[model samples]
Target: MKTWIVLLASTLVLPAHASNHITDSEKKTPLQVETIAQFNGIPWGLVLLDNQTAIVAIKNGAAYRVNLATRMTTRLTGLPNVDNRGQGGLLDVAIPPIANTQNWLYFTYAKPTSEGSTTALGRAKLDNNHLSDWQDVLVTNAVVSGTKHYGSRITFDNKGHVFFSIGDRGERDLAQDLSNHAGSIIRLRLDGSVPSDNPFVSDANSRNEIWSYGHRNPQGIYYDAKTDTLWSNEHGPRGGDEINLIRAGGNYGWPIVSYGKEYWGPSIGDGAEKEGIDNPEVVFTPSIAPGSLLRYKSSNASDWNGDFISPALALRHLNRVSINQDGEYTETRYLEDLNERLRSIAQDDTGVLYIGTDSGKLLKVTLNGS
Candidate 1:
């Protein structure tokens, strides 16, 4: 065995670009993190096709087909021109449950318009080594003239309806308005058609695709198969980040009942709680800047089963929340020693975890001796 050397000379002995795979000494579970691949730009989102292959979205207006083993990345062509402005670019990607038969892939990005940029969701067949027949399924009705707050996370429910989030685009009041798709999670049929049973389908003034409204740049969303619950995490203005159990037609009071204060130190609204709007199950004050969320039901690690894993950017760690059937939760921090700003995380069929970082590294997390 090669003996690891500890340099007593200086605090910063390693080079600036060195790969870090630090494990927490207090961790009871035997797990390991290995950096397997690297990208040229920031990897915003990832979807594993199998253990050895995956697709990654870069924030710099491109997507790549990545080989997990060899680290060979091929840029996927034929995507719509993304408005790669401040806080706007190619975002999340998802594969349908029927991908084996349909060969379809869904993506969300910041689409440019005459007015400005809006969050857009599109789907296309993955054929002939690139995206084909791609078209935008939904775009925000009101295209505001700002580059910030385009909440563009995508997830599919058990009913096969596609759900994607759009941020308020710096327009806080639009979240309360039912007429626009901004600051809401929009659910639609597979063919981009409006589901007739949608809450706003009968309302003449509201957009038919709105599922739940009053979100403020939700970057992470997941559908729990066991509980049939849709969970989302959004960034707060200064200190009031939230994790919510999403429901149809639910109004998550943003700018109205925020636990968070304003960026310059003022109350967001009247108070923390309101009458009709829903409150978040979890609220993080002083802000962790949550980037993505995952619901892990791993057979290998029974301790981690039925737990929610949220990777954060500001905190630079993976958060583990163990929940019981009664809805009580205990929180822990995983991969705390890595000290990297993680972007997205996913798990394979065999219970292996893959993590993407803002520093352009792809890491695999697994139980030791597995």
Candidate 2:
């Protein structure tokens, strides 16, 4: 979940001009930002079917099939019922790798249940501009009540496995429990069946769907086909936001080895590192509140290939992280002048980036001369 801080109403006021070119003295190309559309609700997640058509999910229980060319938003029907409580609602939307062939749309949401709300995964056929033939694939084993930490993000790997994350739901201890789905990344087939090769498939006490465990609240996840890597960004306590390289059956120390301090200023866990617990590839001490993760892949932007791009909510900027072959990285911040809480980002086929903000606006970022 995003920080409890509410955005100032003034942040919604658009600039006199919606487009501007921002250049860094050290870079060759300037980043051109354009306001494409503004929303009345929080745009939680988005995916572009083509360069001009997008399916956007709102945190307030709604989804929209937006026409980027015309600045039109059509509220999509046939979505599942969401809790609509704190940090829960229509979350991430993703297309399978075989989208063009299968026409299937997969999404994650906080599903309302008698016991409480649970992170749920479902899919439907996207045809004629509406969702049809809805199928509920998976849900968390334990449904606890909370407004924070649903940890819902979806990604498809090249090996035909679907991975989705679920937060600890404020139950920090649950992260270490493999029998429960909370605080873990789960892998399954496109149809929602557990993959036999999943890490815990043969374990009697563990959930077979679990791929990795000990996540707090991971809002951003991406699969890097080049490295065959699964990467995730999760929120820590007051600090300690982390970007991790995920491995099957891996144990990430949550409540045990966090670098973050507690909300009231106490150290979390037994310092930052511990034996047998996986360490993060990157840790943000000040907390960027990362929202979405995308692996940049383009023939044109050779320099940026394999880098990770994402919006930082608390930091109010877009981050371009260069991950080198040696597994080290450097971070660059972009669009700081926008000063809005960015929630989601997607890149079009042309390599242009689209970003959604908590200020209820949609923005486009392109290379200066593109």
Candidate 3:
């Protein structure tokens, strides 16, 4: 294994402006990025089990327990059979924030079916080297013919609800449909029951578990308990990637009102704005292809506290968006020189960041002069 340390310079300060064409800038903070370990498959999701140990979900239907202190990895057993098709496999893994459910680990993966596959949320307990009492919390009704656009990422609101995202499943119209679970954010109780207060629970035409709909392919989601915000970043067709402030029952206008062009070069939907649809907080025109998101909360002041960080898969950079009190934000890109397709990110107790790349490498990032 090889290790490289790269020093990141300070971000330039820029005024917050409109969501599209937002510039990148930040306060001066030196950063050091180091390669810590290498894995056999793409580390799709990373969650810290404790201060020194983490569980990583591989994209090819495997999981591993990685010790950050000694750089040793143990292959975890007892995971469900995952369909390792295109963009389908073992995806995001998360641990509940509440104290009582800390023993349970949550997961989202592509569960195979007769038609095709669907994103399923499941949970289990880690028993030494194996998982015990594994249970599928919810098998989403999103099976389709293709294998792309699974849109599986997990987050919790710390208020007895767990939220996960599912893509449009390669069907554009499914985003606007309420009958199925595709192209929506779902909220459920920790035990797999639908939350009564969910946005669409009362409507017989909609799925009871849906929180919001009209999403293309949200790969990154984070809930901020302090501000009561649910944030998501999703991909667009040719461009127009978006970071949205998700709201209950809000329609985000995927194919209906997109700023992106179709793959072959025609505009999408009724221009970029519609009356009732919610607009994105930030939009990326050329598509960074965000894989995972993190709301950085740290005791240290220099660690970009309270900012949104995402790993860019297509652009191969660490993307940061700094938000102010008014909900306006700016963007900053880091580590573009490394040229790695960053896949997942998790932060430790000491404000250090651990990043997983599509190249099967784990990286550690720290504030250099802090």
User: Which model scores highest in lDDT?
Assistant: 3
Off by over 4 Å in 1: 1-30, 99-101
> What would the TM-score be for candidate 3 when compared with the true structure?
0.94
Write candidate 2's Cα lDDT for 1-370 as tens digits: 1121211111111121111223345543357777777788788888988999988888887788888788788887788899889888889898887635368888889899888899999888887667898888897785897767998889999777899999998899999999899899999998888888898989999999999998998989999888788999988887788889999999989988887889899898898889999988877767889998998866575556677888989979887776556555666677776789998999987788889999888888875434
Candidate no. 2 TM-score: 0.90
lDDT for predicted candidate 1 compared with the true structure? 0.79
RMSD of 1: 6.8
Residue pairs in candidate 2 whose N, alpha carbon or C atoms collide under 3 angstroms? none
Question: Roughly what TM-score does model 1 have, to 2 decimal places?
Answer: 0.90
- The deviation in Å at residue 131 for candidate 3 is 0.5
Provide the overall lDDT of each model, using Cα atoms, as 2-decimal numbers: 0.79, 0.82, 0.87
Alpha-carbon RMSD to native, per candidate = 6.8, 7.4, 2.4
Among all windows of ten consecutive residues in candidate 3, which has the lowest summed lDDT?
8-17
Which candidate wins on TM-score? 3
What TM-score does each of the candidates earn? 0.90, 0.90, 0.94
Question: How well does candidate 1 score on lDDT at residue 224?
Answer: 86
